[model samples]
Every structure is written in structure tokens, then in C-alpha cells.
Target: MTRGPGRWAVLSAFTVLAVVMLLPFVIVALNAVKSPAEYSSGGPLSLPHGLYLDGIVQFWQRVNFGQKLLNSLMISAAVAVLATLLSVLNAYALGIGRVRGRLWILVLFLLANTLPQEALVYPLYYIAKQVGLYDSRLAVVIIFTVIQAAFGTYLLSAVLGDFPKAIMEAAAIDGASRWRILWRVVVPISRPTLTVLMIFFFIWTWNEFFLPLVFLISNDTQTVPVALGVLQGDKMMDATMSSASSLLGIIPAVAFFLIFQRTLTRGVTVGAVK
Candidate 1:
């Protein structure tokens, strides 16, 4: 089909929006590799005179960046796996099986999703402290898993709703139990949507700052963002080195999104249609 003027206009507008959103990162990146003198004298939009590794080296050493990176990856991966499994099970039961008071159950999940983060923070802190989970990696992992699970359930349910009933009925006729149908049928057909959710949850948990800050007090257990925040809060962080560290912090997240860009688009669009 020939492209229309309206479609072209919309595309141009979207391109502009994307650039605007990306502008900060672009500026930070330029500043990261620039010397302190250049960072201060040169405009953020200016091109760098040369690449410098000092900022990155100093940032890495001071923050123990390698350890923080692993901490973030472990927490995020655990959350994604646990959240996906629990959400898929909940969604399958709700979407495919007959149950009593399903509407109320869904209403409760929606309510849980809407609860304010600020309101829950103190109570969550208390609970974690009581359980001796404060300042631990598992604490943040558990919190991320639970918080993301509500929205995950909602998104998975939407995807499952679009599934045809005939396939499930045939599976039941063949003596397939609910567990078999869920594992052998529902999951296989829902790969795209699952990929989308997994990526979304991973990114969200990986980038999470407040929960990590509240739960992780020890330097050893800190995730990337919390560790970066510590670095950024230091009096010396106003230098170009701080900007470099900030750039480093954003690199993994950007790479993850790029890798999953296709699945994310499909998953989001599919969920939206229902």
C-alpha cells in the first residue's frame, strides 16, 4: 500500500517524541567521556574533544560496580522468573477454569495494583525488619516479585483471554489435566506475550531504586541503582566522574530494551487489543 500523508505526519511526530525522550541520555553520554574542564565549560549538547577513561575507571572502583551489577542481575532475574510463573498459573486458572467468586478475586488484584507505593513503604520496611530480611538481597527480590506479580497477572490474563476454547476442550477430552493443559498448551501458545512480560518485569525490577534503597542498607547487598545513588550523593559526584557513572548505570537497561524490542512491542500491542 502507498503511504498516506496522515501516516507520514504521525511517524514524524513519533520520531520527534523519541528523540526528545532520549535527549538526556545522549547529553549524559557526551559528558561522561569528556574531561572535567570540558564538562563544565562545554555545553551538554557540545561534542567532546576526546574520550577519557578516568571517569569510568574511578566510578567503577569507588562503587564496586562489578558487585553491584551482579546484585541487580540476580534480583531482577529471580523476580522475573518467580513473577512469571505465579502470574501464568493465576491467569490460567482465572481464564480457563470455572471458579467461585472470581470477580471479587480479580477486584482484589486490581486494588492491590492501585495501592500507592508510598503508603506501603513503611509497612513493608517494618515487615522486612521483623523477619530479619532487611539489608538482604532476598528482601529486595521478594519485594520486586510481589509488586510486579499483580500487574503481571493482569497482563497474562488478558493474553490468555484471547486463547480459543476449542484447543483446551480437546486437550481435556484426551485426559489432559489442568496442569498439563497449562504447561503443554497455554504456555506454548503464549510465548510472545510471556517474552514481553518477562522483559518488562526484568527491566522494571532491575531499574528499581526505592525498594532497594529501603531494603538494602549494606554496601555488599546494594543493587546498581542504589549503589549509583550512593555515588551520586557523594560530595565529589558533581564532577564529570559522576556523569560517567550515571551513564554506566543506564547502559544495561538500554541494552536489555534493545534486545527485546520486538517482543515488547508485540506483547504490549497484543495485551492492549483485549
Candidate 2:
């Protein structure tokens, strides 16, 4: 089969759109290698005359970038794991289990997802203080896990609900317990959905800023986003260093997407079939 002229025209349009979208990132990467003086003199879009590593080095040392990166990775990983696990259980129960009022329960979870973090931050702050979890990485992890799980449950419920009931019935007839069937049968078939959920959880948790700023008050506990926010507020801000830090901050997320790109593409249409 060969594409017609119309298909080729559409492909060309999309190619142009992709380059337009990537322009900002290209500019940022170019500036990341320039010195602050060069950034100011040569303009943001100008290519660096030579590779200058001083900006990156200065940013890393000034902000304790290693510690911040570790903190972000740990918190994001914890949230992703916890959220994915809970979402799986919640989706199984609400989507597949013959439970009463499951639709209402799902509606409640959807509503919770709609509520902005700003609206709940004050109450959460008070609760964290009362529970002695404030200023701890565990606090951030727990908060993000719960928040991300709400959306994950909603997204995964559709996939789980669409699963074939005949297979579950067959497993049940074979004397497999519900727990065993879920772990052995449903889980294996739902790998694509789980992978998608894990990727979303990791990316969202890594990039979250507000909740971390509120819950992780201590410098040592602060994640990358909050640390970057603080860096921007310093009296003497360096444009090139800031650009370098921004680039470094996004590397983990970009790498994660690249690693799971195939899984993500496959998962998109996973539940469309039986």
C-alpha cells in the first residue's frame, strides 16, 4: 500500500508543526552551553561560539543539584509505585468487582481529581503538621501518591472494565481465588495499562511543585521543582545557569518517556479490542 498525495501533504504539515514545537527546546539547549555574558550579549536564540561548561558547573554546585536530583527521584519513584499499586487495586474493585454503588464511588474519585491543589493545600498543610509529617519526603510521597491515584483510578477503570468477563469466569470455575485470579490473570493481561499508569505517575510526581513546596519545607527534603523555584528567587540570578538547571531538571522525565515510548504507544489502543 502506498500513501496518496493527501497523506503526504498531511505528513508534511505535521513535520513542520513538530519542528515549530521543538524550537523552544532547541533554543534552551543552545543557551545552556553559553556563559551568562554570552547569553546577554549574543541573545537567547544565538548559538554559542564555543562550549562553555562553567554555567552548568556553577549551577550544580550553587544549588546542590545532586542532592536535589536524588530527592526528586526518590519522591517521584515512591509516589509512582504507591500510586500505581493503589490504582490497580482500585480499578479492579470498582471496574471489575460486582460491588454496589461503584459508579458513585468512581464519580467521587473524578470529583476529587477536579479539585485543584491550591484549594486543598491549607487543609493538607494543617493535617500534615498535626500528623508530624511536614517537612518530610514521606509527606510529599504520601500526598502525591494519593493525588495521582485519584486520576489513575479514573483512567485505568475504563481499561479494567473493558476486560473480557469470560476469562475471569473461566478462572473462577477452575477454583482460582479472587486474589489469585487478579494477580495471575488480570495483571498479566493489563500490563500495558499498568505501564502507562506508571509512566504518567512518574512524570507528574517528578514535575509537581506546589505540594512539595508546602509539605517539604526543609531544604534537604525539597524536590527539584521547589529547589529550582528557590534558585530563581536568589538575588543574583544567572540566565545561562538557570537555563542549564532547567535542562538538567527535564532530563529525567525525557529519559523516562524515551525508555517507555514503545509501551506507551502500544498501550494507547490496548483496550479497544476484546
Candidate 3:
């Protein structure tokens, strides 16, 4: 990790890894605009003969892509926010408050996080059906909020456990209640970590497939991943159109990551010049 001859090896490794990750995107982008005839003849690795818009346009319209975008954005944003808040609250109680048997409580959250979604599918489906939330985005939102929050609590609790007791004592002496101190002091100090958590939660929820597939069977409630699956399975789809679908599916998540990427770097570099 330190600067040395080893750094060159690390850089070379990352360069190769980056190329591998980016290769699919490049292929998809090129093929998204390739005519079916060209794609059939030359395949995905080939350069496009011309700019073909029809397949991309048709795929977009066929999938009702705008709705899928909205659903994915809404669900991911909701889960990210709700999960972060829940994690903060749980962490605050366990770490800062030091509630009795807090070790067991943290363990409980860790186990909840480690538990596979497969194990909960049937119960979630049944409960949602019983409560009339099945096939609803709200149900998915609720499920992921709890699921993501469990890990967040596990992580943030440890971070807060190392928080400066001196600062907390100073705040208390200045007449700050625990509630006020949490929002005004604790949350502010923890913003970078919380932001990182939010970014991961948003992206993770955005890319979720299986649970979304199982629960969001209705076209009206489906997210981008679900829509991509639907697009792939459609009998009328062509190779070029499938590529266009993949390209479309990738753009939003990539855009989100790139935009927040600045925030991530900023968080890490904030104190470097100080």
C-alpha cells in the first residue's frame, strides 16, 4: 500500500481490472446502435456499421422504460435513506447509549445481515400477501430497509463506539440533551461514513434482482433489473435490441456512481491539507 516498487504492480493490476470491468460496457455501447443485420453478421465484438436508432427506440418504448427508471430510483432512494436512518438510530442506542447487553444486540443485527434473502422470501411473500402489500413497491421498500439497515447498524455501531467521549462530555456540559447532541454533534461528525453507507445502499438496492423479480411480478411495479430480464425474455427482441436494453439498464447506475464518486473522494481528502 505504501509507495514502493510494489506500487507499480498494484497499479498494473488495477489497470487490468479496470479494463476487464469496462470491456462489457464498451461492447454494449457499440452494439446498442448496431443494426440487427450487422450484429448478426459481425456479433457484439464488432464495430457498428451505422448508427441504428430503431432498436434502441423500440426497446425503450416496449419496456416503458421511463416507468422502470422511476420505480428503481424511488425504491433505491427510499431504501438508502430509510436504511441509513434506521442504522443510525440502532447504532446510536447500542454504541453511544451503551444499552445493557448491547453486544448481543449487535450480534443480532450481524446475523440478520448475514441471513440470506432466500430464507426470507417465503415469509416475506406470505406476510405481504396477507397484509395486501404483495406486488407493491412499498413492500419491497420495507423489506430492503430492514435488510440493509441490519448491516449498517453493525458497521456504524463500531464506528461510534470509538467516537471521542471528550467531545460528547463537552456537549453534555453545554446543556445539550442526547437527542440534540445526536443530530447536532454525532451525525455531523459521522456524515462521511453515513454518506458512504448511503451510496452503497442505493446502488445495492438498485441492482437487486431476485427479490424484486419474485415480489414485483407486475409490469407496473418492476425496476430496471426486472425490466432488463423482461426485455431479454421477450420473443420479439433482437440481438441489437438486447444490447440496447443492457446499455439502457446500465446508464443510470453508472451515472449515480460517477456523481457520488466525487463525494467519496472529497470525504477521504478533507483533512489532507490541514
Candidate 4:
């Protein structure tokens, strides 16, 4: 009887929530092109008079943003690929192999994800120095690969556990080895899920700042987020420049999300229905 009113109510609530979520990005975009004088005179919410790109340009040059961007891309891509592989192997053994203590090991990985990075910094830092990996992008990649793989293993394990026994049986009957089944059968069937995980891993590692900050001390070794933090610490930084830096920092992450949006949607839909 009251369905129409309830429908409108839910729609209205979601509309407001969407705006709240997007307001910051909109404001940043609006100000990214606004001259400082215009920004000061018109305030943040007001429409910009015209495009102003100096701040973004200056910040990019100052930070050698190209190098930092490359560092981030290299590190995030390595972590995504390496972590996904590591997770697949671990999850395959524990989930599909039905190994003893699999449940406990999954639980351990789950718990590991919850442990604060702050708690491990000292040990990680000490180990990096001891291994002569400190302040190197390789060190950051190795560290984040393991950190991200923990979550990946936890997730992929559950997904693979429910994999159809009939299909597995068929593969085994066809004289397929475990290795072939993994590569040819399970992997192809699970490609969408793995793609989704890779996207998440890439974005998660891209936005990571703390460990990158601690480990990547050199300007060339730093990532976008770490570079943004360093720029933000400058006493001479202005609000307009701050907005520019923030916009620059998030553009790659947003681009990646958009590029994989279709795959992400399909993967999620498949996961839900399966």
C-alpha cells in the first residue's frame, strides 16, 4: 500500500549519500583548474573563472612526478601479479587439496591482515636494513606483495573451496595432473575472480603511503601518495596547490578503477550468483 512512498524515500536517501561521497572529488576538480586569486575571491563552492594549471605544473616538476608515477606503477603491478600468483598457489593447496590444518592456516592469514602495519614497521625496517634492501623499490614491492597476498589468500581460499567437485573429478579422470588442472581448468574458470583480485591489489598498493614513506626515503624511490605527503608538509604550500597535488595523486588510481570497471562488475556479479 505504501510502496510508492517507501521507494521514493530510499531513492532520496541514496541520492544524498552519493552526493556526500562525490562532493570532495567535485570540489577538488573545480579548484584544480581555478587560479588562486579566483579561488580566494570566489571560495571553494563557487564556479571557477577559468583554468589555472600553473600549480599542477609546478608541483609535478618539483616532485619529478613522472619518476614517482613510474615507481608506483612498477611496485603496484609487481605486487598485484606476484601476490595473485602466491595467493593462487596457497589457496589451491589449502582449498582444493584439502590439506590438514587448512582451516587454521586460513584463520592465521585472516588474523595477519588485521595486524596493524605500525606494529610490524620496526621489524620490517630492521630486516630491510639487514638485507640491504632499505630505501629500494624492490623492498617496498616484496613487503607489500606479502601483505597483500595475506588478504588474497584468505579471499581466494574461500572462493576455491566451493569450486565444483564434478569439474575437478572430470579433470582428474582425463589424466590431467594437478598442475594442468590448476593452469588449464581452475584458472580459466576463476579468471574473472582473479582479475578482480588483481585490480584490488593494484589499487590498494597504489594508494599505500605509510610503508612507502618509511621505506622509500629517496625522492626517486617514492610513490604518488608519499610524494603528495612530502609536498603537503611544505610550509609554503597553498590551498590551491594542495588541491592540485591531491588531484594529481588520485588520477591514476581513478583511471585504473575505471579501466577495470566492467571486469570488476562482471566478477562481482559472478561471485554473487555462484
Name the top lDDT candidate.
Answer: 4
Give lDDT: candidate 4, residue 113: 99
Q: Compose the digit string of candidate 1's lDDT tens values, residues 116-213.
A: 87888999999998998888998888887888888888766766876899999999999999899999999987877888888889998998888788
Tens-digit lDDT string for candidate 4 (1-274): 5679889999999999999999999999888888889889989898887789998898888889999999999999999999999999999998899999998999999999999999989999999999999999999999999999999999999999999989989999999999999999999999999999999999999999899999999988999999998887798877788899999887888888999999999999988888
Q: For model 3, how big is the CA root-mean-square deviation?
A: 2.5
lDDT accuracy of residue 167 in candidate 2: 98
lDDT of 3 at 109: 86
Q: Tens-digit lDDT track for model 3 on 168-252?
A: 9999999999999899999998888889889999999999999999999998999999999866777889888998899999999
Worst 10 residues of 1 by lDDT: 94-103
Per-residue alpha-carbon lDDT of candidate 2 for residues 109-174, written as tens digits (9 for 90 to 100): 999999999999999999989998889998888888999999989887887888899999999999
Answer with 2 or 3, whichever has the higher TM-score.
Answer: 2
Instruction: Return whichever of 3 and 4 wins on lDDT.
Output: 4
lDDT measured at residue 78 in model 3 versus the true structure, 0 to 100: 100
RMSD each, Å:
2.1, 1.5, 2.5, 1.7
Q: How far is candidate 1 from the true structure (C-alpha RMSD, Å)?
A: 2.1
Q: Give the worst 10-residue stretch by lDDT in candidate 3.
A: 265-274
Q: What is the lDDT of candidate 3?
A: 0.92
Q: Score residue 68 of candidate 3 by CA lDDT.
A: 95
Model 2: residue 90 alpha-carbon error in angstroms = 1.5
Q: Candidate 2 lDDT (Cα, whole model)?
A: 0.88
Off by over 4 Å in 4: 1-3
Looking at candidate 2, what is the lDDT of residue 126?
A: 96
